[model samples]
Target: MTDKLNFYFETAKSAKIGIWEINLESSQVFWNAVTRDIHEVPHYFIPSLEKGFSFYLEGENRTRIKRLTEKTISNGIPFNDKFQIITAKGNVKHVENIGQIVYKNEKPYKLIGTLQDITKEQNLIIELQLSVEKFSSIFSSANDAIFIIDTSNGLITDCNPRSSELTGYDNNELIGLHNSKLFPVELRTELRLFLKYNLNRNEYTLNETCIKTKSKDIIPVEIASGKKFEVDNITYLVCYIRDISERKNVEAKLNLLSLAASETTDTIVIANEKGEAVWANQAYLDLTGLNMEEVIGHKPGYLSKGPETDLNASLLMSKAIKNKESINITILNYSKNGEKYWFEVNITTVFDSKNNFVNFVGVGRNVTQRIEKEFALKSLLDVTNSQNNKLFNFTHIVSHNIRSHSSNLSMVVDVIENTDDINEKLSYFDLFKEGTEKLSESIEYLNEIITIQQKTNIEKTKIHLKSEIEKTRMALSLSIKESNILITDTIPDNLIVTVIPAYLDSILLNLFTNAIKYKSPERNATLEIGYEIIDNYTVINFRDNGIGLDLKKNKHKLFGMYKTFHGNEDAKGIGLFITKNQLEAMNGKIEVESEVGYGSNFKIYLNEK
Candidate 1:
């Protein structure tokens, strides 16, 4: 009996199984060597029933083992169950336990159980479950229609839900269906050839084709086949089919738009968000006289360069592009050959479906003729208004001055006729002669004004502006010195102005004399001359430190023939009147900024082209 017991113990130890026994009456516990090793306890370690139960983990493990032992003790019912335990080294291990009760005198006497570690087997089962769940999730929720095809016969063995929805067929109808039946009758042969060619290849193959639905409607689709795989002994292919009807529609629309852009007469250009040209229509190319090679990677605004281009307009365009804004502007741009043309363009920013700025679209056309006509009409209107003002002035002078002269002459004749004295009559002759001379001077001034008005169409020559100002200053040197006035000329020496020679000289002389004549009595007088280009016109500014006029009270009469502001004894007022007319004849204009006690600034605008 002892030899058989020893043999069973050795076998259990070798098999890595453990045994435990509890004495009911004495409440003692015993562990075999294998059980001691499983709990990581020393061979000589003492054991008790409570200590044996403590080795089981807390919560479920502890409660379950206690219940099993109690049941075996009360009813002698045997148990085979799994549990977890913490070893002496603080390691967790899964174990299978088997328990049976020993009876004595019709009552339980002892409990015995067998345990085996099963951590490795439990881990493998969990891993397999997770992998199956992951594959099932992906296969069920894939976006594209997926099919598993038996490559040997090109028959559909399995398919995802999307496949049924794409083909308007049920799962039962799709399974075992021939792959060629999915395509239109006309395209089935080609699709079969393509599949056969790529059957054994180790790479995915892609093609665009049409699929016929069960309802007999043909839908465009992009078909892609993943590398062939095998399950068991049968080879299978994963065929992915995606509907491409929307993409094809978009392509067709883009092609039509491209045709319109290429053939239209208006200029159209597409540029990247950085303002560099990416594409241009034929009209844009023709307008700029540039080929695609020259335009690409360059800003379309490069065409807005030349002597005549407006810098402000160019700056506005650049600012608009930087801010991703839309703008409409008419600007003068020069072609490759230096030919200037007025271009009216509307530039708009392009955005993607995500509302991200991507590019700019500029559509423009040549507006040179319309702009030139507008300028001509404006010039004609200015001339008409000037002529009307002069006519009004002439009528007022005639009505007031002719009647005064006639009344004075009549008075002189009455005195001579009523005097009846030779000396008296002779004295009246001197009065008559003085009146006639004043009348003749008035008539001469009017004639000069009429002559200035008629010289509107006279030819203009380009003259050095600073040189002319210097000459006029030299001519008025004596008066300048007498009035103690300082003159400052800041105009560029190379600055040239197109004007009638006599008119420019006359204008400069009037401006200089007026400054000297109006010198302030309280302080040293000074005049500064400067020039700037604005709105396609050259503006000459004459700023003076002098007693300024109250323009609010005298603005209307300031340029009238007989008007005067200051109480100067020699204030004739004819200088400014004639100066304004002269400027008008040359299609130029003058504006004055003046305050009562401060100073005056006179700006003369001349057409630059």
Candidate 2:
């Protein structure tokens, strides 16, 4: 029996547990080695009930342990307590103690108990409790209304303080209430159906809906709900609700503004101070053939001009933006398909309420038909001017030719009447014949000009460019060879032009003849002929290294009737005028670029068909 008891005591000591007992009648106490070690006492130190009780910490813990031990000893009950104790070494330790009374003759005699040093376990439990308290405070004090609802019955099971405040209700008022009652009357039915569907499908839904406040007023809310669950437990709905009344009002105002802008008829374009487009009304977008997305944030100049558009319009626009004033002008513009048109544009600068420049607004009206009428009037004026000049030149030529021929005729008649010799008579006859021939030539030249004017109907055909150039060169071969000119043919072989055959031939012949006739005496004449396609029209260039005219002095009359720059004997001064007329008759045009002493380049534009 002693050996077994010793083994048990050894086991208890090895396990770091302390055992103690006390007698209620004698107030005696006993303790094991482990218990003595826990108190930091010497092995031979005797323990009494009073001393054992004193080992407990002061304050509530000491009182608690003492009362428990006394009750168990006097009333034959059992007591268990977890408390703090201070050892002899002045170290604090956590202990769990259990005491039971040992009854003698059905009455309490002594109490026995076991004590466990549980300092580490007690500290861990305390840290866990603190962490739980921190999380609880955050959950309860959050601003967003949070609720846990029972999925089966749609009842509110839990709610945060914010939820109660937002609903104008207390925790007790909301705890057992159905969640559907919080929704507006019209939305409650929809929400109930939605919940049922979501439960069946096991999916989450986030949406905006109206909620009824305690005062029966509907408030816009955005609710995000999802399932919350634990292992082997039925899932409940967790919802977070936010007020969105202000956002909804802003969106409604924006929608109204958009609709108003779209329906307005006036062209409205809003651009930043830098001339970048910010917004445009529907009328403006439709007129410009551009979408809002394409124009926004882009410079308005990008849509107003193209390759062939007048550059002056862009310059004027820049000036207007810089000056920050309303500018009105008629501008030539290009459409999306490269068709040129005109617009009467009014650009005004917009300012903020504080009187600072903010943006520019440009309103434009298409004036293409009006400008076309203006061009037609100008062309008519040009034709009238040409007719007046032609009449004047013809009068001069007719007087000079007729007067010269009549004088010769008079001399022939005088010779025939006065001299009876056969040789004199024959000489007079020959003089008359030569004079008549000269008269016929003058009449024929005049008739040729009239014929060109009358034949305005241009018969278009595909004329090979290289072949036409070679033919012109062959016709003017004598002039080219005599002048020792170097002619470079840069005309592409496959290139062709659509024009009347007669007009094309006349245009080329006149240019070739002029290039040779105007050859520089000091240098070998160089002529270059080439062609290119520009905007659906074929442009043929004839360049000559000759004594160029002073274009600045006589550019206006360079292609006018009876105008001559060089005083060469063979200069009729009618070739360029005739060439230009012929080109115009065939729906073509001619432009000249020249510099004195360098050279001249005559460019002809013809349709490609």
Candidate 3:
């Protein structure tokens, strides 16, 4: 028996377990070497039941383990328990005690069991339990509503505390409810569609949808869902939902602001620092005659540059972009069809939240009409200045000419008065009379110039260029035939010019008379009349194959009053000056391109009206 007991003890030690036997009547307990080792004690350590009980915490666990051991030994009942044990060295161990009651002559005597050291296993179990508890706490306290719905039935089976709070429902009220009850009527259809599409594929999705609270109030929610399977062969859809009412409100307000920006009437373009367009509003599309696809990602100059655009516009833009400064400028731009327009653009830099330069926003207005008005005003000022200078020169010429003629007349009258011979007196009187008549004619001519200067209400009418040329030709028929000059009209038959009738006639008459008067003695005076329409102006070119002036020396005085270059017997020098003044008064201009001994080409620019 001793050898058998040693073998059993060796087997238990080899198994790394402990075996214990308790005699309930004597209250004694026997522990094997392994059992003592499990308690962190010496092999010789011994313990009693009462002492072992003391090792257990003072709680129902201790009482239950003691009662189970006592009852098993006294009543022949089997008992199994996991409890704490203490050894002679006062070391405690976690042990799983499984025992059976032993009987002698049909009466319970002792309890026999195996004590397995389970401290490591118990510690792992405790750690797992703690983790579960912490997870449960977080799940209950989370802000988002969490639900576990049975996929097979589409019924809500479990929900966290937050779910109840968010849905305005108690746990009992929500656990057995259908998921449809939590969704608004409109969203229920969407939910059905989503399930049909995703359920078969086991796909997950996050969606913004509306939910119905217990109070029947609709709440916006963002829902994230995933599929989960349980050990019991049950499938569940785990859904996390969050209230997004505030987010939705902010989004709505942002959408409204975007809509307002897009619909604005001013051309609005946003460009990145690289000078690439990032965003453009509807007004920009309308103003530039380009679609969003065509303009976005392109530079602003893409829509505003053409052959006639000023190079300085791009220079200013480059400087402003490099310095990140706001700039305002007026630029001549082209539309999609290459039609020229004027834009007044204001560009400003936009910064990010970190105050870093991010983009530039340009607001442009179509100032084509306004710019044209400004040009018109400037042109009028130029005309006014020219007219003023001409008037001053005309006044000076009138003073000089009238004084010369008056002095001549005065001298002649004095001679006639002092002379005794009737014949000499008569000749002096005749000469005086001629001088006075010449002065009178000069005064009349000055009055006509004054009238032309003061007259601002000249009726504008469209006159056919060919017919007007023909009329001037007919009116100067006597001079044309006398000068032996050849006149050719190369003007288009349908070409018409907007001008005052009298001014057009006078202009044509002056040009023709000059061509005849300055005819080259060595060459036939061939005159050519033609016109071309450019933008909003009609350019009439009158080229004369005549004895052109020395432009290098006389270009400045070519249109000056009383400045005669040819010194002809009938060179009054007033014709070209008055023609220039009249052309300017009518918002037109005359420019001459000439080569000495070659020919003169007079270009008259008249408003197209």
List clashing residue pairs in candidate 2.
Answer: none
Candidate 2 vs. true structure, TM-score: 0.44
**Model 3 regions more than 4 Å off:** 1-249, 271-279, 295-326, 334-340, 403-428, 451-553, 565-569, 579-609
Quote the positional error of residue 350 for candidate 1 in Å: 6.6
Ranking by lDDT: 1, 3, 2
Candidate 3: tens digits of C-alpha lDDT, residues 425-532: 877767877888888888887886887788766778888888988999999999999999999877888887888888888888999999999999898789988777
* Model 2 residue 190 distance off true place after TM-score fit, in angstroms: 7.3
lDDT for each residue of candidate 1 in 64-173, tens digit (9 for 90 to 100): 99998888888889999988889999988888889898889977788887878887887787789999998788778888899999998989999989999999999899
Instruction: Choose the strongest candidate by TM-score.
Output: 1
- Please say which candidate is ahead in TM-score: 2 or 3: 3
Backbone clashes in model 3 = 0
List the candidates' TM-scores in order: 0.65, 0.44, 0.53
1-609: candidate 2 lDDT, tens digit per residue: 999978878888889888888877887889998899888899999998778878898899889988887677667679888989999989999999988988899778778888889989999999999999986897698777888888867798889998877787788999989998898877988888777776666666778888888888788888876666543576787788888888999999989977877787656677888888898888777667778787899876487587767788778888888788778888787765666778787899888899999889887777889999999999888877876776677777678777888888888888799987988798778789988987787677677777776676656888788998888889888878988889997777887778888888888889888888888887989989887788978898889989998988999889875578888987877789888878766767899999888889999999665
Which run of 10 residues does model 1 get worst, by summed lDDT? 194-203
Better of 1 and 2 by TM-score: 1
